[model samples]
Target: MNFKHLSTSVIGLLVLSACQQPVVHIYHEGLSDTQRFQLKQQLEQQQINYEFTELATPDKYNTPHLLYFPGDVTEAYIQNVERIVKGLGFDRFDSQVFSHTGHYYTKGNLGLYFPSAYSERVLPELLFAHNCGDQDFQIHIKTNGQWTAMNSPIDLKGLDLKWEFYETFFKLRRYFDDGTFQQQVYQIKQHQVRTLQGYKPAVTYEVLGHRDYSFSLFNCDLQAIFAD
Candidate 1:
């Protein structure tokens, strides 16, 4: 082994690594100044765990990059911009974390996703779904600053309703073609209880609605906030 040659090669590799920058590229030209600042703050504070270069040009490049998406674009935007990239046979990371996880469950928009919860008189609830022994979804409400998690709330089993395409405030579902039809047992006391990690304090930011369904932050944690 030539020690001098190996030392020179190590320095060369360090130089090459230092020169390459991974950028968070913003493609949406319509972003307002406030929105841009908010996105940057969110990424820096909670989302990104590494340093990055912020790029904003439309030029083609050979550097490694990921597209910074605001998670509010239409499906057509993917077909137009992203599809073109794929059509040219390029693969890249997209930062729209809520692409399919969930969306805002607005008030009065309750008709969109909470018809069943309302019908059972259990509209004000937090839903949690996970697979312990088969997929299980539980409902809870904050009562007197404590969670009324069990004790005969609107519990669902044999969940077989399926919706896929795009999620609107009207359809509050993530996966399709599963056995997810609405089956609820209201006002019955439940003996089984468990805790979900992501919905609690310090695990995720305590904002309500669509963000509760985000893939990155919530990730099968609290599926939806059904109340105002």
Candidate 2:
């Protein structure tokens, strides 16, 4: 091999590799000193190129930390950064992408919001499904003296229930061929619980209502509930 040509090829590969590397800018406020040290160590361990700038004032975004990346970055880079920050005891962080044109946009952003250390307790959520097979049914939940209709694979988070101690009454209406609905009601108590992770379904309640139809509840992981 010609030595001159080999040297030129090595230089070209190095340039390409450097261009592909992602540079991350971390803006943080309200982070303890130990947390900051751990974050830096994690970033260095991952060989991630990063810069830390302490915000003189509280972050306008109103979050503990924010990770800003270039618009051309990839998902792998984003995940690595998220894993590092979350490992540092920050359960929640927001991320955004900045264009080369100096404009910020939310397109293709993760927009993840997890429960942080600030929250005293995680409110239990309800997730339920029916064993009626192909039969279509309507569900409504009444809490604090108000009733609202709901859909199956029911999640109480979307129902906007008050974050306090209360009893939720579920109404299940299963339609039959006779143009009538077989209705049943279920009562479940709700409260908050302290958890290492975020809020999850407290318990799986198997409600045996009508002879032909019944529904059961189960705990769902955060990923399953938040999957796009």
Candidate 3:
């Protein structure tokens, strides 16, 4: 074993590892001055390379408070970044992973929309819009007090609802063709909807003559249950 050759190989591996670490570019759009300062300070303390950048335009989705990573990034890097952000009272949602952006690269950089404020203090609200293709349904909401029947969209304000720092807990009922209803409980970010268990299992369904029917079920919508 040549000592020089061994040393060179170790150095090359170290360089490659360093290069693989993503450089975080935090977009400070809705963040306050103090929040921005604290975020940078925390990143520096963690020895993570990061820089502040202006908010990019054409964000048609209107999601200015999410952390966007490269589609091809390793899950480990994603978890590390999430842990760091969580320390600063930032909560992430699953939908945020698919944020659209024009900043694509071979070696992707991590981008964050660090908002100054979060909506955790606000009361949670539920909106049940019937979209099961005219299928009549019954809804129930579990609260700290008791299980209440929810006919229309009801505000959980001044009501005892099961909620956590970043998620709201509730149960959904799915009507089956066999004259049976199955209860499915879910804990999701506020303002997000979860399909009733086993709803829309496929992307599309073939119709006899009209066209391919897209599978979509907008059962309900919860609002103001997440941290910004």
lDDT of 2 by residue, 1-228 (tens): 799999999999999988666555555333444555777788799887766644343224444433344555567776777787666554455666544554342433322222222221222222334444443333343445333324545433333233221234444444455676544544433222335565321322233354443322211111101110
lDDT (tens digit, per residue) of candidate 1 on 155-180: 32333322222211222232336644
TM-score of 3: 0.41
Better of 1 and 3 by lDDT: 3
Question: Number of clashing pairs, model 2?
Answer: 0
Q: Model 1 misses residue 16 by how many Å?
A: 17
Q: Give the TM-scores of the predictions, in the order they appear.
A: 0.20, 0.40, 0.41
Candidate 2 is scored at a TM of 0.40
How many steric clashes does model 1 contain? 13
lDDT of 2: 0.43
- What tens digits encode model 3's per-residue C-alpha lDDT throughout 90-141? 4442224433444432344655654323322222332233433544233344
Model 3, residue 183: distance off in Å is 56
Give candidates' CA RMSD values in order: 19.8, 15.3, 17.0
Q: For this target, which candidate reaches the highest TM-score against the unseen true structure?
A: 3
